[model samples]
Target: MTFGEKIFKYYQQINVPQDLPTGVEVLYPFDSTEVADLTRSFYMRYFNDKRPRTFLIGINPGRFGGGSTGIPFTDPKILEEKLQIPNTLDKRHELSSRFVYQMIDALGGPEKFYDSFYFTSVCPLGFVRDGKNLNYYDDKALEEALEEYMAGEMRKQLDFGGNEIAFSLGMGKNIKFLKEFNRRHNLFKEIRPLPHPRWIMQYRLKRLDEFIGVYRETLAPFMPDFHK
Candidate 1:
């Protein structure tokens, strides 16, 4: 099967129970027919080949980003405009998505960058509490409850056969959790931590280009021909 086919199937198989903990809501964009179709279309268009890709793991989807578009780190505007993947979701721009695409552009554009890497969250699905985004590490009980599910999803992605080096988006809590998880599971050879795009965009906007440069430097070693 093609890479896109595998991803499409993976998303289809994601089944998070509705009766989550008290205040949590699983933001399943795939539930929306428009999002589901758009996701599949995006994958089919850009990920049609079977090239091995490195993994870049984010914490979870944001409401206006992956939660709406069904693509990791992608907001509606980026999906429609930058990716040229038409969608009917609200066209709200997300800071994280903007930084990600900017880094993508710096790394020789989407076609080359995506061809060598896959973007996904540690938890395949996202969660929210009282309309605010929640990370898996936000609640200890919730994290323990979903450990098996999250590990299963990670293993499933590994089955696709990519570079063993995984990039962790958030260097703080998210990477801390991932390190512990990987120690127990041995999921990846290395989990390199990077600043979350949202954090960089929010607090270090003045150093935007510097952050992009950091992304390029860190990712370059993984893709030898990246700058070419």
Candidate 2:
């Protein structure tokens, strides 16, 4: 199977993990027909090849972004505008999505960028606490409970084929978590951390270009040669 085929099947077969502690609800987006279809279409469009692409792992999907569209960092608006994949999901734009696509544009747009990289998360699934998006590591108990599950998923994705070096989407806790995860499981050669797009858009809005430049340089070594 191609890289995209494996991903599409994994998501389609995912069931909400049972007995997630009280107050924490799973954000299982694949159950909906629209989200599942959009996910399949997007993966097939860009990732049908047998080539291996390094995975850029994020914390988890936020409510307004991947949680609704089933594609990491892609909000509904981006799904329609940038990807040209029409969807019934709300058209609300996410700051992270804006920053990611801007960097994608800098790296020569979606087709070129996606040729070598795929965005995902430590936990392919996400959770919500009190109706607000929650990171997997937000609660100590939840984090511990999900460790084996996260590692198992990571191993499964790696077996599908990718680079030895992985990229962590957040420079803070998310990186810390992934680093420790690697230390324990020996998952990658190295896990490089990138500044979280949400943090940058929320705090460093004026310096967006600088961060995008950082992303371009950090990812340059892995990018494949392609015509402009």
How do all models score by TM-score? 0.96, 0.97
lDDT tens digits, residue span 30-104, model 1: 877888799888888878998878999999898999988889999999988998887777899999999999999
- Model 2 misplaced stretches (Cα beyond 4 Å): 226-228
How does model 1 score by TM-score?
0.96
True lDDT of residue 140, candidate 1 = 87
Model 1 residue 205 CA deviation in Å:
0.6
What does candidate 2's lDDT look like per residue over 24-99, in tens digits? 9888888899998899999999989888889899998899998889899999999999999998888999999999
lDDT of each: 0.89, 0.89
Report the CA-based lDDT of candidate 1 relative to the real structure: 0.89
